[model samples]
Target: MIYINFNGSLHFKTDAIFTSQNRFAFGDGFIESFRVFNDKITFETLHENRIKASCEVLFLELEKFNLEEEVSKVLIANKLKNARVRIHFFRVGNGRYLPETNQCNFLVEAEDDNVQAFHLHTIETISLSKQYFKASHSLGNIKSSSALLFVLAAKEANKNTWNDAILLNENKAICEATSSNVFIRKSDGLLLTPPLNSGCVAGVMRQKVLQLLQQNSYQIYEQNFTVSELENAAEIFLTNATKGIQSVVKFNNKKLENNIAIELVSLLNKEIGL
Candidate 1:
């Protein structure tokens, strides 16, 4: 039997914590996901800060609740040492489009994972998503539950038999991948990723990668670029909290390299003491 933590209380996964009235009516909530390594939550401080920012954006008050302790309790209850943990925070009261209360409730779920550390993996192929585009807005930076754009982009990728799809912003500039931040390396060894104004999620791993690159004195820039620029890249990588770095082997017919990505994985593991 699997157990989950709902608003600081333990219950079976089958238990219903919220009803239709108070549930996530319009997908009005946000999520935080991270990996737990050897019973420790990786990047705990970053995750917590992101959660706090997300709550503030949605006007949900945490009010002295201990998120880290709740997560630890869920991990202990599930007996999971290495796991993928997700926490969903939603407003508690309901009132059509506008919520009646700013108070929130959360559910924590943890599942066992096989990966013990960050590793480099190559995506065989990826393509630009043509069907949908992510809107460039402040809300786009939040990990909100309403992710239909990404969901549709993933479907488009699967339909084309591609490993993943690159999503463009409404302005037709590169934003991010289906579920990760996009990065490209030019032949001259310069790294480029879309800025927050380009409507990409403020990914924790993306932040860490930028810091790592700067610490190592690598040239990197966060600026908007076109598809033509991406096609000319010598290497392309996607980063998220769960998957450290994933290199794309092919984009359209262009072959890419993974040398930098592989090196970053080593640096990341060492920095995390993994």
Candidate 2:
């Protein structure tokens, strides 16, 4: 096999890395991620909507940004079909943390893939401040650049032999993982997860599962639960756009009962016609 690298920019295509000069970039943009499977995209609208909302939440005032169209164009330019995709919008820093009013950039990357599962580890973490209980707070529940805090926690999970970390709120209630929403199966048939009021990212998959639970009249709870509840949970599972639904085999050095998780997977699979 052979590969070649070239300088200078061209039009938007697989061969073109940028649309303008090196110092050229816009001041405001949004990013999105999607999973392509069997030549189809699941929950495509959800991913697009999240990108739009993320930009709006970050207060990035831009004249126009089209994420879905850009993604489609990039896929075609690269002669690609299905995989995981990420799109990030960039703008010039306003000489500070904020962005300037003019110029912007769009960054997109995708790859065909295959994945089995993710490993999870228990980690130490500090919850958010009481003032951040509301989503209207600057970084609360926005799914933005605030992942640094989660990164620190994920280090603890890795140090202690885990893939990621779970964070709690100021009240010591189980919130969510570093990059995903969490669920715990109870003795009852209800599926349990933290509510948006708990200061966690409102994940799209989480939304889908919740909708399924509600539609079938399955007992479900969206209230605060403690770490102890997580440990003693009859079943523990995790979900994200990338990972889908994963059963937690072990947590805090204890093995979880994956029976409920397996059943829930079957239930969800049946519901989604997967």
Candidate 3:
């Protein structure tokens, strides 16, 4: 059974539902996705705060609805102990080029994702021939409804039988993966990820991992590095709220080590009390 909360109303998966064009496909909005583990929602408040911040950045006025409450209700109604949930928030009112009203609309969807343990899933990635998303774009950092660059990257990855694609910013600096933040463990034992200014989404798990590593006295830095630097990286890992940390075993044809990634995954699972 599947359940969706569309515009403050709940509907079963089989129910016929319709959303207006302005709110469905063409609108100013963003999405926040996280996992519910052991019947507890991970980083729930963090995701909510990010959502609110994104709305402010977009100048969107949201309609009446309690986001956390709605999410909880959906989980309870479906008896979901472990699930991956996505909340879509978009503008509701009219206009062709510009929306007459900026009131926001929300839709929530969840699927059972009973991941009881954290394991290192090594991924094979390929670097794109050209930069797709301009990290310097106005809405680049925000996970907006307009995700053409991400779509293109995914299509390219599928064509090449790759697990993910590496995206670069305007300056040809490493940015992030399509849906996950990229991290490179250096040969000298330092971890580096692109700074937020480099156009990477401020992911919930990324922040958590940063804090966890710092607490453990690990040397981690957020700075831009070139593709040449990546070629020499000792290890490459991806982080997201759902999968936690995934080690990139190979970037194109270069093999990467998983020693640090495995340790970090253990530390992270312990930090999250999973």
Candidate 4:
């Protein structure tokens, strides 16, 4: 279920509707995040930065949208305290391949999300599918609406009873999961995540985790790694804005140690004051 606010006014929609000729309906849309905390929105700057970057990549105008104000209005009108809100921007006008106007229309959707952080307790996540095409360098990092690949992977995960599936890159390097960034804690106690070149989304939580790790002098590296490295790791975890740090207790039949994940989750929650 979703509560929607279109533009500035309170609006309700039975489902997301777009014209047949709309670029967004044709898979050309973008999504941004706004996390609500204590009746106020947090990480406005980060969200704005990401949105601006996405617009630049997609050639959309950012000057016409007032996202910050729209988010505040939606939260207040809906009487929400803590939640995960998504602002979806899409081209509304018609065109064969390109929209007549790049002008974007947005719909703000909010859902109840618990405030407490969580860690994954399940062991042995399934491998959904082999890597397909590489996400283009110009468009890879931004969370644009180009979601067919992710949608299919997520569907497979749900169907297979897997918590999440690991995605590989065109080169067969471990990229990320369906909706979260991947991390591995080495036997010697170092952390590693896929580099931007690996086609993983530059997740806000992933960025925050890297910052916190560096601030605390923990050894961290960003590079392309393979599934073999994952099987050899002492610990595995996933991170996103919604879930913070979730330990992947097992991948297939292998059980992973949670010692580092536990320590990091505690430290990260404190660092972010969650």
**Cα lDDT of all candidates, in order?**
0.89, 0.60, 0.81, 0.74
Which regions of candidate 1 deviate over 4 angstroms? Answer: none
Model 4 per-residue lDDT tens digits across residues 1-274: 3457775666655754655666766666788765676755555666777787877777776445676678767767667777788888877677777567767678887777667443434435656355344563657787777777888887777777877788887788888887778889888888899998888888887887788788889999998877788888998888777666677767776788877668777776575466
Q: What's model 1's lDDT at 179?
A: 88
* Tens-digit lDDT track of model 3 for 33-113: 888877777877778778878888888877566767888778887888888888888877656667777778788888887
Give a tens-digit lDDT track for model 2, residues 1-274: 1111112111443454545533223323444555665445567777767766766766554445555555565555555665677655555444443444545455666676653222233322222222222232335556654345666776666675675567777667888877778888876655689988788776777887787667767778898887777777777777777666777766665666665456555665564445
* Number of backbone-clashing residue pairs for each candidate, in the order shown: 0, 10, 0, 2
Per-residue error for 193 in candidate 4, Å, reads 0.5
lDDT of 2 at 121: 32
Quick one: ranking by lDDT, best first? 1, 3, 4, 2
3 or 4: which has the higher TM-score? 3
Per-model TM-score versus the true fold = 0.97, 0.75, 0.92, 0.88
Q: What residue pairs are clashing in model 2?
A: 26-91, 26-103, 26-104, 26-105, 27-91, 27-92, 27-103, 27-104, 121-162, 190-219
Off by over 4 Å in 4: 1-3, 15-18, 114-124, 131-136
* lDDT by residue for model 1 (77-137), tens: 8888888888988888767886788888888999888778988978899999999898999
Query: On a 0 to 1 TM-score scale, where does candidate 2 land against the true structure?
Result: 0.75
